[model samples]
Target: MKVLSDAGVNYIRIRLWVDPYNAAGQSYGGGIDDEATVLQIAKDAKKYGMKVLIGLHYSDFWADPATQIIPKQWKGLSDEDLNTEVYLYTKKLVNDFKQAGVTIDMAQLGNEITKGMLGVRMGNGDINVWKNEPYDTKLTNLLKSASQAFRESSKDTQLAVHIETPNMYNYDLIMNSLKTHCMDYDVLASSYYPFWGWGGNNPDNIANIEKMAKDKYGKKFVIAETGWPFTLQNSDGTPNNISYDPGHYQVGPQGQVDEMSAMYKAILSNDNGLGAFYWELAWIPVKAGWDNWQYNKLMGDVAGTGWASITSRGYYPDSKIMYEGKSASGGTSWDNNTLFDDQGHPLQLLMMYKGFLNGYESPANVTSSADIRVTKIFNNDNVNLVNPLKINDQLNVSDFLSDSGQEYLNGITGTKISDASLKAIFNDLQDRKQSKTYTDKDGNKYHYEFWLDGQTTAEKLNNFLKLNSGMKYGETLKVNYTATLVKDKEVPTVTSPVHVTLNKVYGLNNVTIDSPLTVGESMLAEDLANVQKAVNNVLTGAQGTTISGETFKNLQKAIPGVYNATGALEGIKVYTTDTGNHYIYEYWLTTDDIQGANKDVKFGDPINVTYSASLKWVKTA
Candidate 1:
């Protein structure tokens, strides 16, 4: 609590499980964080002068994105009856906590609730797993009951609907479902651990998350629980020799601090963002309690011996790093600002072509002519054209005027009119002394095609040339073009085979392919088959404009592949036999220790899995 309060963290979330003891009447040890335990934590936290948020895990045991096991007491209850139980449980917990003199600033009816809690139901409760369903009757009843309980218990305590780390795409579904159900949640709470969720800091994804939360909830957003581990251990029960740098994600005190700083920075700036809460300080390493690796061994607060490292580490406060405030190191330096070209990417400026005009040499004869016209002038990036008369439209260049604009506009390669053809056309037009419209091979319309006088102003010539190049006939050129748009033509973008990797294992048989039409997105296997169906549903007969980011990411996740596990890491090591030394690194979560031990850890049981090393392979040949 002090660490958080010192770090500007005001609120703490403590989870509560209902009757964590089992049907067999076995009382799970370890406090089980039951109602009694939650109240105790709340009391302790308030004594420390910290705000408290009670996370009500309605189940007897753990609940998560994967499992929402029914509470032991509620197991025999019917679907309709379960809803009442949820409401009563929530109301009782809140009232009890209040009676205990603990002010509950906020309450989460469920924990990390990507899917709803108390998932099993009596009738129509089973979900079509293939569909990767939204809240069905069972989940709806549970949520509705919980929401009612929170609402009825205390109007002052804010209700937070906690979900998995914000995936801009899936978060929409959660918010939309809540809105559709009219579930009243005061704050949008999410759990974000970059290493496990959302992969890493993807700016596009981060921005999407901000937009989705602000747009959907229109309420304050808070990170309910988020933090990184400082130490990592291999599955083999050995300490990972690799150490983290202070400044990055490599794994160390500084890296954790940096990550926290970055996360806070991103969140506080979000208009709808409220604040964040650290998980638990009790889990911090201590000398006389559980083993160092019992929970968050990487945490210095838990590892009491390493208190100095954490206390001394500099944490750049929110007010200082955010809102344009600078650091003591002479303020921030923006050394990497750059301009993007037509494709909306950083442009690498380069001079590919340059043409100079020799001071006009008098034409010896009336017909001693050159195609004296400006053709194409490409920007340094070569992605954008810088001609004075360039077209401004989103359609393909071919859809615009002819003049071979199709070849020059829209990142297309430009072509120069052949010297012989230019001369012949110029002579014919000059003889006729007429201007006529012409349609180019690309089907663009050009009017008043041809050149005017050599003494014509550059502005007028530039305008005339814009259309003249596409005209069938117009004023003939008396002089040759001093600068013609020349290009060492290369084709536009070509599709490259997109490579996808799954951070976790998926069965080959469990995988299903969908959306055979859209080339960019295809779902492979082991994914909720419905996701593939969703991909196919959106992609089929849909134009490029209709394809969404969700559909695209789902397809990426669904790419069919099998992982080969070798060595004694209990299938945690995946290596492709063909690749000499390349392997996909993975860390798995197991319940064996937590389950085999003296406790029936409830749903939303906090567990930490750390990466020790990337699988290494050697050349056998």
Candidate 2:
């Protein structure tokens, strides 16, 4: 908190949960943001000369676009009783904060209440009563009760109704629905992510939404949550919702800076746009697994694991450690998108905020599309003779069928042997009795029966060709490998390249080599080899693993004769094999900060060194 204050951050938004503990007194992992915790955080923020924005989740755990489970204690209350309960809870929470000498600058009525809040637990399970109730009266009454309590407790605190999605249509729907129910709210809050936005994150779209909220509804608008990922990899063993999608947005530190700069401009452009908050700015990597902490215990009781645990209650005798030091199910998927690195160090994005506070010009760049790389493999026999295949070639397929057999043949060989005897041999290797149907995009189905018998299609084909044909072993075959680089049409926004500058304020001694470093012909070569090993280790970890900047720096230092190194690798190129396993085959790293030598290498999983040399000796007087 002090670090952020010193860095020019003036406000901190803290979420308050009604009751985040389970029957066993275990805390849910989201943050035991109970009344006491909220008050404590508020007091701490006040000490740092920062204002507090209180977000009331109104649930024991999380409440979002999906399930909004009613607090367990308030499960069986009648509709009227539930309204009264909400009023009382809000009033008490406000009074508690006031008594603690903490002033609440803003208070959110509900957290992302797009679907609805306080879901009524039907006999079967939790259901959204707000959507089904007559005229949305129940939801209106509940909001009115909570809002009135907030006003009675502290009339000065700004009240906001939070929702998700950056689309203006969704914003209008939420506001109109509230108006129809005769509910009042002072601020309109929404969550925005460029990758998840319906039409992509357009500055114009954000500007229009802010303008519309003020003009049409006479309400202040604020982005409660917005962020971009520095890497596509998830710290936890879960899939990241926001990643580097070609044409949609760039994925890296610079990309985040660009997106954030644009967002700030859009918000500040409108007088009614209060400001935006970068969600989960302080989240950092931690050891995975369950412990006796309140949050961990709650996770154990509720779901029998940590926050990422995907298990049932009473399934395990106790919460078992899943991975690293967190839950086995998954941990923080947004860690990469955080303002800090995995090691809790501030990222380059923090400088963007500093620049904004210092009155620097907002980042300016027109959005452009990224080139999408598409790879399609054809059978060895179906190359130039039939389809005219070539590398770096573009082919428009009005009708395309992606089948196992097609991909398999492409994997083995691409061109058909022109010789009649070779063609006969290939035909003899196929299993003509078995047939399978494949459908094209146009609903046209084609039947295929030819299949080679072996451990793999490639092996079978290779064996047949070698035994019957004059092909030499280990010789390169003219296989039509087609790769297409086309501009992304769906999302046509590309961010500027990232410019990195290492101040060298931190010494290189902090670098820790995890694996053994083999002493090769040179220390630089050994370091490069060690770095490659570490990288491959991470890539083969949980799916979606990404390379970190720290790891990249360590590798550069390993290079002999290099004073400093700073560069970033392009996003990993992923391809799914026949067994449905995704693997990265290629990526490039741009390097600089050499002492006096330039090194070249073929970048891949195990980077191949094509050239190496030591820096020239410099003599000092």
Candidate 3:
């Protein structure tokens, strides 16, 4: 805290979650910013002699423009009841801080309340139609209620309203509505990120907004939040969100300074520009490693180090459904964007904020403690291709995890990094370079090349692994490579070659399936629940979305004559034998929906499922 205070940072913004615990009392991670947690943070910031600005989320967990889940305690609340809660809750929060001898200089009423705050329950989903209507009126009333309570509780604290993605429309709507309703607020702020910058990173747009805010609304303006990644590298194996930039700034510590400086300069354009708050400068991966998953998870659940905990899953469903993420997730996802490295050692960029006061100057000894650790090891070693690969068979990172796959050790050469998830290796391999050639048993030769920015083979995998694009029948790809890091004084050499190959053990010619009895109470293999499970787990897991299929089951029992291969080759469950060659068969999923007119696809829906009939050879083992 002194590190920031000494560096011209006089204010600290902490998010306040209403009740970040489930009924079981396990924390919901994310700083577990329940009343006690937020109060303590506020008290600590005060000890450091910095003002506190609590971004009251209103919800128990995350609330934003996209999703603002109502707090578990506030569920089933009517609009009027919710208003009362916001007032009472915020008022008590202020009074308690005072009682604890902590002063809150500023309190952001809501965290990015561009959408309906508390929860998104705007009627007819058309609040824009009537800015003076019930939806807007109720929303304003809630803010007014909170504002009244804030003023009543403490005359010392200032009220600030924050929104992200600073633009005119939402800002106009929010500010205009507030003005219309005669609801009081001191500042109208927005998060000015590079990608979501002030009118496309234009500093002039900020000046324009500042002028308008002061002249029209008579309000102070500031950038409530902003951040840029110091490096694109993942420290704890979790992917960083801000990998690309429109400004095309080089990614490193110096780059972070430049990006932040540009935004800060924009804010400083006006005399009353309160300046920008770096979103999360110290969110580093502090003492968590892959070798201790259980320990890390326990700490994450109990200490709020991670984005979420499994114990809090029931309360937070957005993470559960959005892209099928795990409920208990790790963080330091923002470790790259932090002022410190993954090891918790401060980066040279830590001094960047201090530079805003005087003139910008590079740190005298601009060095980093960061290291390139082996994150992902190849997981998909052996796979069966049921269909010839086609154009646009899009690949996913999860498809590459194999039990027997290996990765190059850091600094030296050969060692299997079993600690890394297949996801990690695949994520790292996405941005790469090198080339190779392979010839199959059929004598068909293929050559492939990797590039840093080419769609043919992006990050070593993509459309490049298709039928006409290098991949061939019975060919095992040897993806050999080596790498060295550029020292910001040091990293390691990747000397061991990562050999990756997958065999198309079964193809259409060798494998075929019959429905057994096409009529009567007939059942299709793809229609069986077990077959669907196999397709999702086995086929998609191995080949990604390219080959959509499930096991052609009820085979030996239902179609004994055709689907028989007892002349065993290893642990043979069941296979086919046109020749002595045994093969596994499966029915492919349909591309077209059973009813395309009704375009409703569940987020977790299988890649292949329709009325149309298609078959693919799934796997050998």
Candidate 4:
């Protein structure tokens, strides 16, 4: 705290949990950061002459988009009780700080609550996964309750509403809902991680958000949470959340300085931007040994040692189960992203924040994150497009769109947005049987046909696939594509000398093998939304237009599902001994039910088995 304040840091953000105990009343051990823990931290921050911002997770343990477990005391409560608790708890916590002579500068009601907070319903309810009707109203009720409580406690202390920007357009869903509900708050805020590619891999959306918050809502915008890794190596036995991804900078101390400086510069660039908070900068692990790890676990206020504890498994809906095998003590997963090394030394990057004010470093042009949505989403991280597509390779629209946008594309809802995931969603989704095996529902074999630019061809249907799926090569472009299933049972007959009898197969009841297609998202919609949201910044589009940020993000989430036959990750087999041969052999006999290999294949389908009979010949010189 002294170091930071000395370095010109004026404020400190602290995460306040309701309770962090387990069934036996044992500490779950991350930091066991209950109210008392938070109050003490606040007092210390005040002693250091720095303002405090309390981030109420409203959960007993970790509260994020995926999991927002209400305090155990609030469990199985009525809607009224749930809404009332937020007010009572928040007001009491604020009053405790005041009574203790520690004044809070700002209070963030919820953390990374893009979906919904306190979602668990009566007798174990769910948090709102997405912003829809009743849930949105429920979230607003809590926000309204908390906002009132905070203001009642001390209006001088500003309040911030924070959400994680998984999609830049998610702002519309959350912010618009807040507006419609008339919820009052002082600052509009979000969590942005460049490594996570928040808001389409660029701070362009950040500037837009700042502009909108000031212009439309008359609120200042702040990046409440932001951080990047300095190293991929973990000090504790537990693994890190960002172990390998360097993102914009290379790994180590200098990398941390570079990323932090960049983050700072990006926020200050905008007129209404109120600056950013570097998340978990001091969250370091205890030691490298096992006994020490256990000792550290025993010291948690209850489960604050690592990202989460084993005891937190039930409440945290998803991803938390991942810690089942690792240290239940919850060793550090964030040390790589913090300011301290494994041995407890302050890193050189620790002073980067102060350097922005004191001019400790030499002049270097600072460049903010660019709109690299195309490069980040397609360039090997999510979907590898650097390798070219081949004929007969199997792929679904998921190759270029995210799973969240699938329902919209299959004629489910919304206008046709730019997408590469909807078509297969309408049909069947399949895994890569082989790179050469057609991924379209029926395991139909087909090839690449790109409609580069506006050039049309007889193969125009296939031409659209690559281009729409974000396929690009050496500056040339490709979009949209197709591959049809072979309905006929008979193709070229087997040339094998061995004869085998096959039974009769019927056609056409067709249990549409639905595509379990997952993963895809491109930047076309985001590119457009950047312009559209810049004007109105609502779920409802601009002044006269019908499109909103959500509309563009939905488009960014996907395009019409295209038949991708690019054999990039799983290519075709060239030799009989190769493992890929098995998939190719399966593709050789694919038809209308290619997706349903053994289950969908009938008793009497075309039976053809091709093998080789080789006679070795040696020639004498």
* Top lDDT model: 3
Q: Judging by TM-score against the true structure, name the best candidate.
A: 3
lDDT of 1 by residue, 483-593 (tens): 112323232332112222223333223222221112223223322242223334323421222223344343333322211112223222334444333343322222113
Better of 1 and 3 by TM-score: 3
Candidate 3 or 1, higher lDDT: 3
> Tens-digit lDDT track for model 2 on 1-621?
888887778878888878776566756655557788879888888999999899988887667766466787898899989999999999988898888788899988888876677873333333433455552577778888999998888999998999776767767876877777877679998887776744736677888988988999899988888888887765533334565553455777677887888788888888998887888887654533111132333343454233433332222213332445444433454667888866576766776666764465433322111111123423423222322334344322212212321222221122333344344334433232222343444544343322333446567566555643544222232221132222112322221112122222111142222221221332233333433444453223222223333344544544322211222122122334344444321112223322112222112223222222212112222
Q: Rate the local accuracy (lDDT) of all candidates.
A: 0.45, 0.56, 0.57, 0.56
Candidate 2: residue 420 lDDT (0-100): 49
Error of 1 at 283 (Å): 1.6
Tens digits of per-residue lDDT for model 4, 376-454: 1111222223244534333344543345333333221222333444243222322111123223344434333222122
Compare candidates 1 and 2 on TM-score and give the better one: 2
TM-score of 3: 0.58
Q: Model 3 shows how many backbone clashes?
A: 9
Candidate 3 — what's its lDDT?
Answer: 0.57
In candidate 4, position 360 carries an lDDT of: 60
Model 3 per-residue lDDT at 372: 22
Give the deviation of candidate 3 from the true structure as CA RMSD: 18.6
Q: Report the Cα lDDT for candidate 1.
A: 0.45
Q: Which runs in model 1 stand beyond 4 Å of their true positions?
A: 2-8, 23-31, 120-135, 197-204, 233-248, 284-621
- Candidate 3 lowest-lDDT run of ten: 494-503
